[model samples]
Target chain A: MIDSIQIRDFRGIRWGEVDGFKQLNLLVGPNNSGKSTLLEAIYLGCTAGQPAHWEGDSFEPAQVSLSGRDFLGDLPLLRVLKRHRYHLRKAGQGPYRDGCLNISISSPAAPLRRFQLHVPDLPILPDSLRDMDSKISRIEIDEGAQVALFACASGRDAGRAERALAGRILQLLSPTQGAGSTRQKTVQSGHKTPSGPNKQRRTAQRGARPSSGTAGPGQQTAIPRRPPAAQHCIYLWYPDLTYHSAGVAAWSLTGKLASPEHVLFFDVSNTHYHFYKTFLRDTMTRVPGWTYKIADCLREVLGIARSFDFHVQFLPAKDNDSLIQGWIAPRDQPALPIDAYGDGTRTALKILASLLSLVEQATADSPAVLLWEEPELFQNPRMLNRLLREIARLIEGKPLQLFMTTHSLEVVACVAMLVREGLLPADSLRAFRFSLEEGTLRSSWFHADNLLSWLERGMDPRIWDTLGVPLQFTLKEQEEGAE
Target chain B: MSAAMGGSIDAFYEGMTEKKILHMLMQRGLLAKVNLCDGKETGKTEVNRRLRDVVGPNVGTKQVRCLVLRDLDERETMERIKQGLQTALQALYRERGHPKAVVRFVRHRAHGNVYLHTCTELDVRVALHIATYRHLPDFCKSTIDDYVLRVALHHETAAALIKRQGWSISSKRIIHKVTSEIPALLKQNGIPMMGEAKDFIHFYAALLRVHTSPAVFAEKILHHAPESELREVFAPLRAAAEFLQDASSPSMPGDRLPA
Candidate 1:
């Protein structure tokens, strides 16, 4: 649903923009082409405010003490802003300049919103302490959330000021509270402060929780519970409403939005056999029907008549810790432990399980984006072909957007052949070849016509050899003595 | 040739055979300026696509000319292959919706030169010379084998071997068998092909080397050739420099030959 994305001074990319994205986009290139970096950038941009959930790390509310780095964990909203400075100058863009890491998203439903975080020069401090700084920064979200800044003094006075500032920022981000309603109560850097009921509410909220284990003796004890007014604040940071709202709107325009799962990424390089089995087991637990679908897909694609069976047994010796065991049952054969299968079979099972899980979660109205990095790992050509075909079916009638990066020519050829054969819609598929040209990252879109022509001529579609000239030879005259 | 003067010739070939031939011709001072294409052949469709891209739309105005050289592959006759190439070119121009042009094929019997001219409506010339080699000529082929034998054995021993063996077996088979038989062929004897012989054998051996065997005589043996032995090996190729020199002359535009 993202029409285009422009990235500048982010990770390895100096400046690059990819426009005219299709439903299913394939980023094909050699290693170090910034494919993974691009995905990371997208993920970061979408989940900007909620950095704790950014890497799928579990959120612990108990980590909200008013001392040390642990307090920073409570306010995940500010973590990404602090990390923005680290992204600066890393792309070889000279000395760090005072520029916001700009992520702009546009949609037909809403006006363009440019989420700008003015990366400050100071090292990242806990939110309780950071409120003392006087530098006023404004982040504008067009027709959406508008963030206003206020300053506070350090020490005991600043702790109360920090809570007030947090409450105010939360007010700004929360959709239920209008920016117009909170205009008169705006606290200035050194002068004005919130008094009366708002201050008392924040003070009460700060006094409810016990001090964290890491909190110092001087630090305030028992941070209070969040007030009901700030309950709607965290919901504003939901990926569905913030980063991927444009995609949601795009989907709505076409009429479908049943599920809220936006993005799923599979990094095959780090996914070991055990790690994959665990992920499959977790998905199967979440969506029980997905297990059967995965089994059917494995049998149809890999020609392996095996069904997954998972059992959780409690161990009394280890204080009743539950251990999950996985078994693969073959038709008319004894059920064997899933670890007995080859890595390829396990990888195939994981991929199919992930796809089935996405399908189970996706609805006609709400579609998800699947980012698969190197699915070709440990998969042979036949398995890859079947996987692609299954993917083609998975996207049918569903609002799923699939993005994959691969170095396999077989995968490229299979996709091209599928499009050529009308198994996948030509318009839905897009291929981009990323290359480093003249010390700058660049991408070229391969036209479907050219790809189909290459396939028709029995040439490797992945190799863009047309950019170079062909070698030639002079004809040899007939030998005099020989026939 | 100075680097400044090295940009004039635009010759495209099917594979390594033409590249070696052109390289040798350049070394021998037969062709002053030549630019050989550096890619492997995919198929006729890709080749035609490349032809249009490299040649550009204004074919008559540009000084750039292309010469396509391919072997007379066993599956097709020389005339049929030539016709197929011409048809492919015409189809490419038509597919691009370019103005129809008169395609004329010319072969000079005296010089053994073949030229295909694609002329505009106004008779402006845009030419592509096509040539096919069934096998390397006897002189070049024999010279390459003799050089290989000399490098693999002592002169008297090589002469005795040639005198005793004669030309009953194929030169490629003879070279393969003799090189394998002599354990010290690569170590004791230096590569015999250098200078002219290196150029000639590279082309000659590559042509015969296609499909029949994976081993290339020039790459395996010539890579081991000592610098001192190069002059003697290249003498014969230098002597046949006139062949390339004769082909470099611009052929008459209107000359038409029977297919």
Candidate 2:
């Protein structure tokens, strides 16, 4: 576990640090408060450690390589990732400070491992990647096929923007998370960078920009080199579209990852229908009678009196696409397609299945990581609380690190209530609200008692600014007509 | 609401009484938010625990402040505690064969105002108030009820409430005199027919021969009081509000806390 994390000049966060770590960390706040960005930085910091490697043989011609401690770090902008400046003084901020992207993390594995990379602020490349000059044209044909496929699914515009800057696609392939493979211990989505070396790691020292004119201004200017001791080629599931009814994430990570110590960020691009089917199929192969357990979980969360038979049916769609759909119904009743059920059930059932998968595969040596963006998506307040309680019960004793974000009052209230009722261990839960103005980012943690105090009294600590318990401050007596 | 990345003031009023009083006393523009203190829990441990909830692990890093409002109860309660302790000690001494015959009584002085800048050890500024009846005894500091009494007696809101409740006054003249000189009567000369309770609402209920809980009656009296009259005695609250406006940084204790 990353016991402590300090981020400096990483995207929106100028300087911030979370001193403590908990098993179930809830990063919460208003939208764009660096909640997601903080997760990305942690992913990058943890995966960008020393002795890292990337295989661009998947691409051609201009084979790009970058793993030198003294590699001249440029502001290489990736069309896939959101970009921001290192120093831009906004209103009320004091002054601009000079710094680069640096995330220093301290864990039992690494006492003081510093992950530093500053993509120098680069100007926009002149020509779109598809219409790039011959020097850059040789790369776009197969520029990170995986990146382009998902980048497009992420949204229409992101895909277009990515192709326009195909020259920098190799940089995105660096897999900015969980470096020094052996130290990572846990696998995300069953994708493993087999443990090798932890010793051959070095920081990227600043070297002046190359003085070659082979690539003009606003064109590809990356210095390629051979790969180093390959380590931590981890996958980071962009948490952007993890909402309900979305397609499966482009990472074919839903394969047989029945291994413990897996870190899965569920950003299903498809509505988790087929993704969970394959995932559950994998889990069932390893753990028999898992279907019955999943049925119990679904029954518990749905709050239905009758038992449910949780099963997936393989059905062919009109377009001839094979759609593996779940068919859950009250026992003894005709099965109904999962599409007939509310999206709430679909989402809750999906998350519960995913969690059960991780819990069954968990190992004592390594605690699996489950990063859920918003567990309250499509959940009714009553069912959401029950779902969270089931979630709380499932992961209680398991060696799993659950990091989730939410804007739901029910989620906040449920955690506090569960903690108070002794259902959720108070120590295991750590929540913080983030605020980032311009480049200066700030964070405030909500202690267990704080959540109980604010929430138990009907105060929404997620939106903690509102005045609590409006008072009756009457002035003069009521008017003559008033009762 | 979105602009304030910094924390707002966490006004830890003692209970609903103090919370209601503070809400009406301090203007909304100056006052950010008010929180009810833990249910009557006392001691240094509870204070630290309470402060930690607002000031999480991000102590010095986060700009958060809280005005912890607890009443400075009457000196009589302290005397009662001492008497009780003395009685307990005597019983133990009698059983253990120790001397208890020459027990001398000592009356400690009452606390005027307690100002603790505990923001260092504790993460935020803590302000404790003593409700000052400006014309009352010099060393007197009663519970928030006393201040509620001051606001209640203002323009005789309590008197009007008494009349509206339709309870018979034990002595018509005392009710008439109470509507104006209630604080002086509460301080120097106790009200006629009203018992020894420090809060005027109890005294008024007693004099009026009304049978209702003080908590219920206090709520009634506060609600009946004019907003204009309540603002008259809200000086200390205004000062506290101004102090809490820039709560991001813990500053020196406000000079006129109990104005």
> lDDT at B47 for candidate 2?
43
Instruction: Provide TM-scores for the models.
Output: 0.41, 0.59
- What are the TM values for chain B, all candidates? 0.48, 0.56
Error of 1 at A268 (Å): 1.9
What TM-score does prediction 1 earn?
Answer: 0.41
Best model number under TM-score: 2
Q: Output the number of the lDDT-best candidate.
A: 2
Name the regions of candidate 1 deviating beyond 4 angstroms. Answer: A46-260, A273-288, A305-340, A363-365, A437-439, A452-483, B1-259
Task: Specify the poorest-scoring 10-residue window by lDDT in model 2 chain A.
Answer: A247-256
| Stretch of 10 with least lDDT, candidate 1 chain A | A53-62
Alpha carbon lDDT at A361, candidate 2: 74
Error of 1 at A35 (Å): 1.9
Docking class of 2: incorrect
